[model samples]
Target: MTERQLPGYRRIANEVRAAIAAGEFAEGDRLPSVSALAERFAVTTGVVVRALEVLKAEGLVIARHGSGVFVRRFAAIRRSSPARLSRARWGTGQMIQDADTEVRPRVVDVVVAESPAPAWVAEPLGLTSGSDVLSRSRRFLVEDRPVQLAVSYYPADLVRGTRIALTDTGPGGAYARLAEQGHAPAHFTEYVRGRFPSPVEAGGLELQAGTFVLEITRHAFTAAGLCVEVNRMILDATAYILDYTFDA
Candidate 1:
């Protein structure tokens, strides 16, 4: 459908968003109060609230508790699958995520634990149901803003005593470290999809309403055709622009 045929709330959001782009409301600037906006738009406060909600979801503005809604200071990172996944990126001890942002990305809230693999995790790691695996979870942040959440699984037997089982994979990250252990993956495959975030994911990314989440799963396989690692990722859609390039 055309934008002009959009709902009232969305239409208002587009106007406010355009104003933001036009510099009428610069980043980090406070927006007119809901009541004031309602008076100007000749609509009720509820209408203005809904319109602002739309903007919030689009990552155009954010509502601060005890303060007010203000334009967001956001920088969109480019996630170019080809370059980020090339051996040049991670093989050199850097990660695909690090290349996506200008500033170095930091891993936070890391948790490493051994647990029975869930159905989804099991199949990816080629593990039997109820088989144990090492699970590593971390939040990747750029410039102090959390942009992605990642969880990876490896068969307990494969990473038994490797750094992959630890919080710090130490130099070269997991994939490179795996190579050292003689299980280097020569091929990688991943699937990507986009959807709205659940409450939990939204909270983790500090996303406002109307935002969508990009879900990605990567399967790493050794030259021997053994699936060694399965990584699941969730990204803040509004914070990224996915880029892909290849030869025909």
Candidate 2:
């Protein structure tokens, strides 16, 4: 609370996060104009636009539209669930994973609907809220930024006409076509958590506000115990770095 007794937009976001860790703001550089930080912090360009919206919610700055605010390039992404949950990485419709990154996912939209679960998805889909299922909904991007946001539900008679009810879940995805329609996924159980997002997952991963997302939820089941899929994902907490190597 010592930053000028804090709160002038978190004291100009702690002096721009200590001038971006002392490299004096460098990544994509550029920051400084919000009328030159409201005339060098005498404050009020709406407190330098809420201190650059708290340094663009801590991913450390970026506001490019008419091209201005900059300093950001921390780019994360380690995500390894045994090499992107192999079955050879979705065998060819590439449900998005770009391995070691040249940054390429780009999937923005997908639909396939059914609905009626949503109370934190009805107890991980053992259903009951109103019970329907089959949702799907995606949204990812990279060079264009976004990040992730997956949804998934499946139980409408367990993925009805398969392709997990279309919108292209083809080729080894939807757990390799639910092991070719026999309910594969002997196990998968992620449940991680984090907060600050969900204005529809921070407008579908374009996140901000003290940044936070990485939700996950997963839950695939079925060695006959059935729970088909439940997914939920969200990601974009400064991109990501979650690795799971196995063999404990």
Candidate 3:
């Protein structure tokens, strides 16, 4: 297609995106300066900036406060709803068991470590920074192929003595046990981001180097608005799509 036939910003964005896909701008590679792109595309710097914005929105590029724009490590994995994710309807404990029974998640790593919670986690869990937390990491497989990796966090005090926290059972999942203990989460708020997986996460999920991954962060809450659980789930983009439905 001719340049004049395409929208100015779109044409620029497409060219840049194509270059990135072709490995001209590999992950963590710096994109050309706005002035450089403008010169290359024979457009004004503003036009080039606008094009970069497109890339940023697509999760193809990231802008650091002091550093210039760089090719983002991962393409944004689109997240929807209605998928058969065990966590969507069940609690962490239950999800683990369901996976073992029907899906059979490959237990890559499970550790009960102590560490200060990150800001994103601390705020939701209603805990101060540096509070002790239980970190649980799980890798799941579908049809014997790696599919999803999830890291869940719970307030240590809340789960410390519970059976759900101590054992990895096959049927009575975490949420079920939580319900049994009278801390059933009635709702959840989820935050979605598009990014490439870290080297460790990528390895665990068995993702291709440049494969895009979707990050879904969820905070489970009770009817009283108390946050009960926080989880971060990473899924292979090409293997599955998150689907959801809404009623009028």
Candidate 4:
């Protein structure tokens, strides 16, 4: 159906989405009261409520316990994957996330350990099942809201005495440290999918019910064709716009 011919709730939702796109209702801006919107749209309060539910499901707005609905503050972070992974970024001591949205996420809750690789992790790293790997895990937060979880696994023997195994990988992160060990990443491959968050993932990212996650597994390979690292990233799907730019 044409937009104007849509049902009352859908029309309201479209108008609100358009207003948000036009920047009329900015991030964290409280939307008009349901009664006000109902009056303005000549619709019932129930219709307004349904409209708001539509926006909430799309992650465009959030409803608080005591306060009214507001535009989601952490919505739609544009993640330019190619740019974020470029050598120029990490090579210059800049974080990969710097290439994301203007808002930079704080890296928090870092944990480094050596553990036997899970079957899924070991195969990608070209290691035998049960091989030890250096695992570095951390959370990415923007404005104190957790948005991402990342874990990098490297062959333990290869990075045992290296900075890659430390909490702080220093300048350029693990890739830079790998360069010193003659395993610089010359290429990367990423596999991405969307799925419901596991209970642990939902808790870690503070995601609302019905929110999905983008699971990305990235493999860094040296020029010699050796896979040096396997990094798994989990991002709140609603919080990111995954941009992949390449030649046609």
lDDT of 1 by residue, 116-233 (tens): 9989889877778889998899998887888899989898998889898887888778888888888887778888999998898888888776678999998888888989988999
Candidate 1: which stretches are off by over 4 Å? 1-10, 18-40, 62-74
TM-score: the better of candidates 3 and 4: 4
For model 3 the local lDDT of residue 34 reads 91
TM-score of 1: 0.81
Structural similarity to truth (TM-score) of each candidate: 0.81, 0.34, 0.60, 0.81
Query: Which candidate should be chosen as best, given lDDT against the real structure?
Result: 4
Decoy 4 TM-score against native:
0.81
Name the better of 3 and 4 by lDDT.
4
Q: Which stretches of candidate 2 lie above 4 Å from their native place?
A: 1-4, 7-32, 36-41, 44-50, 58-67, 70-140, 144-172, 179-181, 184-192, 195-210, 221-224, 227-234, 237-248
What is the C-alpha lDDT profile of model 2 across 1-248, one tens digit per residue?
A: 46567778887778777878898888988887888878887878888888787778777888998879998888787677667766566655455365645565666588889877877677765778878888888888777778888888877877777678888776556788887777777767788788777687887776655578878888878787777788887888788777776675
Clashing residue pairs in candidate 2 (N, C-alpha, C atoms within 3 angstroms): 198-201, 198-202
Per-residue CA lDDT of candidate 4, range 65-127, in tens?
A: 889999988657898888988888888888788888887888999999999999989998899
Q: What is the C-alpha RMSD of each candidate to the true structure, in Å?
A: 3.5, 14.2, 10.8, 3.9
For model 4, the stretches where C-alpha displacement exceeds 4 angstroms are 1-30, 36-54, 64-67, 71-75
lDDT pick, better of 1 and 2 = 1
Model 4, CA-based lDDT: 0.90
Going through the candidates in the order shown, the clash numbers are: 2, 2, 11, 0
